[model samples]
Target: MEKKVQQYYKLKQKQKEIEKELAGLREEIIAYCSSQDSSDAELGSYKVKLVVQNRKEYDDAKLYETLSDPEVWRLLSRADPAKVASLVKLNVISDERIHHTYTLKTVTLLQVDKK
Candidate 1:
């Protein structure tokens, strides 16, 4: 068990070192591309995208208000009343209802521009 744990830690440390090296190389590639004549390039099989991504932070007020809508609540209420009962069990059901939240979004793309 101890040997396995040691090996796992060693692998994790190696992963961090490799990630750092990759990040530095990625920055170098992007800088070279940006200084070049075009924003698009194809290496062998990879393409790099240098762009700002869109981000959104929603207001929970809209979330709860949307839940108050009868139609939306109907779809959810069909699941089980026991879950509804559990909310009632907590007593915060009045202000805090049962719902889910969107946490994160991600996309990966590769582009290589020639300098």
Candidate 2:
């Protein structure tokens, strides 16, 4: 048991070191790609590319108000767990009402800490 725990800790430390080195290398690659005025570069068997992504944020209240159909909003929206839990605690909703609606699964996670 102790051997497994020690191995887990060692692997986590190695992962952190690898991630740090990758971030530094990624910066250099991006700089090179930008300086060349090209999105892609080829190095022997390996190729690297710089990608740009755009994400959109919407005003929920205005969006819903502007929508012609209420069903469209229902189809797009999902329940928030924190809000539901708060409502249950406040006696606004019953646990039995929502209990059978969702499946419950158990997940196991391993975490190692240095002291």
Candidate 3:
């Protein structure tokens, strides 16, 4: 058990070092691609392609103020888990009702830390 723990710790340390080096290389590659103004490049047997992704975010309060229909806001909004949990704790919502409404899951993880 001790030997396995030691091996796992050593592997995790090596992984962190490798990830740090990879992060630096990734930045350099991105810089090179931007400087050349090309999305695709080839080096020896490796081919690199730059991918651009865009995301849209809206302000909920502003959206609500702009919208005429309350139903539209209701359609866009979903139940918040934290608020539901608070209701359950306050006894406003019964445990049986919560159990029927949502599926509960528990996750277990093992973490090794250097002392």
Candidate 4:
């Protein structure tokens, strides 16, 4: 009986941990969705529309295939700054505002050009 009670408590604790992790993940998704790039406002509340102009799914292998090209970074560096700004304005890239210290490194590797 005591062993069964301990097992039951352990199961409950594990369930609570899973729930907490799931909630954290949901918050992360929300943060990513309503990120600074996606919507911006100061002080009071404001409405912003988010539209996914293009959507496609890539599995782990396909994702690796898309990301493993070394030439991509070189091409990005060679792209026009103005065009990169326009692309950012068009929401072509993820809109997470990185810190200034990591700015050059992060932006150069990815197609995220700050406007």
Give the best candidate by lDDT.
3
TM for candidate 3 is 0.49
Estimate, for each residue in 1-115, the C-alpha lDDT of model 2 and write its tens digit: 9999999999999999999997777777777777898776676667666556432233445444543255644543544445545656887556665554444443322222232
* Model 3 stretches with alpha carbons more than 4 Å out: 56-115
Relative to the unseen true structure, what is the C-alpha lDDT of residue 76 in candidate 2, on a scale of 0 to 100? 37
lDDT of 3: 0.59
Cα error of candidate 4 at position 34, Å: 1.5
Off by over 4 Å in 2: 57-115
Each model's RMSD to truth, in Å? Answer: 10.7, 15.4, 15.4, 15.5
Better of 3 and 4 by lDDT: 3
| Error in Å for residue 115 of model 3 | 45
What lDDT score belongs to each candidate, Candidate 1 first? 0.57, 0.58, 0.59, 0.44
Candidate 2: which pairs clash?
none
- What candidate 4 gets wrong by more than 4 Å, as runs, is 36-115
Model 2, poorest ten-residue lDDT window?
Answer: 106-115
Kindly report the root-mean-square deviation of model 2 from the true structure over all alpha carbons: 15.4
- Model 1: which residue pairs collide? 47-110, 47-111, 48-110, 48-111, 48-112
Candidate 1, 1-115: lDDT as tens digits:
9999999999999999999998888777767766885456666676666654432333445544646867655644543444444444666354234334222334233455544
Q: On residues 1-115, what C-alpha lDDT tens digit does candidate 3 reach at each position?
A: 9999999999999999999997777778877877998777776667777766432233445444543366644544634555545555787555564354454444222222232
lDDT of 1 at 112: 53
